[model samples]
Target chain A: MKKELEKRTVTGPDGQTFEVEPLIDYYCEAHPTVQPPAYSKIIENLFNWARSESIWILGFGTGCGAIEMRPLMTPRFDAYRYGIQWRPTPRQANLLIISGYLSVKTLKRVIRSYEQMQSPKYVIGLGSCTINGGMYWDSYNTIKRLDDYLPVDLYIVGCMPRPEALLEGFNTLKRMIRAGNAEGANTYAANFDWYKTNQKRVIHDWDMPDYNW
Target chain B: MQQFEWIQIPYSLLTLFIVLNFGLLLNALMAKIAARVGRRRGIPIYQNYIDLIKNYGLRTSITHGIMFYLGPVFRLAGGVGLLLFVPTLYGSEMFSNLSFAGDLILALYFVFFGALGMALGAGESGHPHAAIGVSRGLSQMTMAELPFALAVFSVALQYDTLTISEIVKAQQGSLFHWTLFTNPLAVAAAMLSFLGSMMRPPFDVVLAPQEIPIGPPTEYHSSYLALMQTNRMIFPIAKIVIIMNLFFGGATNWPIFFAKVFLIYLFAVFVGVVFPRFRVEQSIRWFLIWAVPLGVLAIVLV
Candidate 1:
């Protein structure tokens, strides 16, 4: 555990001392719950339609696949026309594109970011590396399967998929959202312990809280 | 002036509804224009509406504190307050909104009020990016507002009244009576300051998208983000309303109002496309050196 995260006593400005546990005090410790769809089917459908049309992607690049995403914003691809926009923060983004191979080290940070995203969020495993580690399969530090650590709603398979393939993958994800098929957030909440165990198995130095959110 | 009537409540709400919708569409339209300049198709005109719905429909929202909750509220209030206080149409009571005696000063206060509220709210989020953004935003806003404040004072001196409606009334009857012709120096200064407030390139260091990851709203998401997005639509248009009334002759009806607002908004968009972004210090210096002197001269000549 980090020294700052450990339980310690500190003196305040008024000279009174109090115990502070950074993890518990600073972050919400309550586990995330599965949020059901809206009460009326019509409303849920409207929400699904809206979600499909406006996808705010978290701009975090886990691996080499991130390079491919740049072209989508360029004049040739222009994914903005398709309602796919990049958001700088995880809090604002609904789509998390794990672009390529995830090492155990990067997976820890990815888990933290994934947990921080609001419910009804999605994970897209991009490139062959996220599926079965691609060329990094024999490496000691790489994660073989992304689904083992997080709920992946879709996969765009390639060593590094072209921008065109990524655009197709986004369209497919949009269809899944509109059809009410993408429920990866709820799946992760339901199988929280199993995913955590698998995550812990590979990440030896799991110094952070069980859930960063 | 006529006595305050209860019927004006709905009348003002009607104005708000129209402005809100217009602002949303105008924003999307401006984005499309910018995209076209880059030779791309850009987002649909209805994209802002879809984005708004998706943000509001987001299932979860977390807050840092009461201030975090109030940040967007204050921002929206600021935008609404500015719009309602300013007269939208010249001589027409139905669209005049809640304009009254000394509304120019009140409008100025409302303009700054939202930023202050946002500063406090973003400060409470405990994000370093938000803090940096708030500080940069406040400093830039203060400097940018100087030229505008000077221009407002010069306009007040030139017209010999502080009421916005009176200012509009004085500018009526002929095109040459418009402040743009009567007080060109003040108009020039105010127009320059207008670029800073519009949050476009050359003056958008406060948001600093690529550098600061969206500044004050860094920690905001879901419904909270939705509220800020709503303000984002209204605030710019609200500011433009003030400019239209003050510089150009105030509009007489809905169609003219829309046209004037669109043209004024396009001025910023045109400049935004032509220029690259400035660093915070550069923008502040630009305002002080170029804009502030014109305002001072406007006041001095008046």
Candidate 2:
């Protein structure tokens, strides 16, 4: 565990001392609950449509495939017109694009980020690597199947999928969302222990909270 | 002065609704214009609305503390308060809103209110990036506001009144009587300061979207983010309305109001597209050296 995250005593400016457990004090330990769809079907549909139209992507480049995402913002692709914006913070983003191979090391951070994101979030397993480890199939550090760890909505399979393929994948995800098919966040909450065990099996040193939120 | 009436509440709300929609559309239009400059297609005009809905629709929302909850609330309040206090149309009773005696001072206070509230709220979030962003934002805002404050004071000095309606009334009757012609230096100073406040290029380091993980709103999400997004639409238009009333002649009705507001907003976009971003210290120095002098001269000449 990090020193900052460890239980310790500290003195304040007024010379008062108090015990502080970093992990307990800093993070919310309550587990995430499965949030049901809106009460009315019509309202749910409206929300789902809005979600599909405004895809705020968390711009965390996990692997080599992240290079492909840059083109989506360029003139040729121009994903902005489609309402796909790249948000720097995980908090503001609803779409997590796991762009390529996820090493055990990177997966730890990815899980943290993924957990921090608000519910109704969708994850995309980008490239062949995230689908089945691609060229790093024999490597010990690489995560073979992305679905074993996170609830992946769609997979754009390629060594590194072209920007066009990624766009197609986004379109498909939008369709899924509009159809009320993409409930990955709920799925993850329902199978929390199963996913946590899978994550812990590969992560080894899982010092952080079970749920980052 | 007109007596306070029970009808003004709904009247003001009507004005708020109009400005809110106008602000959202204007934001998209400016973005489209910026994208066009880069040879790329921009977002749809309705993208802001969709984004707002999507954010509000998110099921889960985490908070650092009570302050985090108030941050966006305060920001929205600041935007709303600024708009309501200032008269929208010059002479129309329906659209005049809640403008009262000495509204210019209140408008100025409201301008800084949101940032202060956000700073406290972001501080409670305990993100280092938020802290850095807040510090940078407040400093930049202070420097940017200097020329604007001076220009406002100069205009108040020029017209010899603090009431916005009176100021607008003075600028009425002819094009040459507008402050842009009557007090060009103050207009120039305020226009330059306007770029800084607009959060576009050259002064956008406060948000620094590429770096520091999006500044003060790093820890904000879901409904909290939705509130801030609402303010983002309203605040800019409110500021533009103040500028329109002060420099250009105040609008008489919805169409004229729309045209003046769009043109003023375009001026900021025009400057934003042409210039590259400046570092915080460099921008502060730029404002002090160039903009502040013009404002001082405006006051001196008046």
Native contacts present in each candidate (fraction): 0.76, 0.94
lDDT of 2 by residue, A11-122 (tens): 9999999999977887877888899999999999999999999999999999999999999998999999899999999999899999888899999999999999998999
Q: Who wins the lDDT comparison? A: 2
lDDT for each residue of candidate 1 in B1-302, tens digit (9 for 90 to 100): 76799999999999999999999999999999999999988998999999999999988778899999999899999999999999888899788889988899999999999999999999999999999999999999999899999999999998899988899989999999999999999999999999999889988888888989999999999888889899999999899989999989888888999999999999999999999999889988999899999999999999
Best by DockQ: 2
List runs of model 2 lying over 4 Å from the truth: none
- Range of the 10 consecutive residues with the lowest summed lDDT in candidate 1 chain B: B88-97
TM-score of chain B of each: 0.99, 0.99
> Pairs clashing in candidate 2?
none
- Measured against the true structure, the TM-scores of the candidates, in listed sequence, are 0.99, 0.98
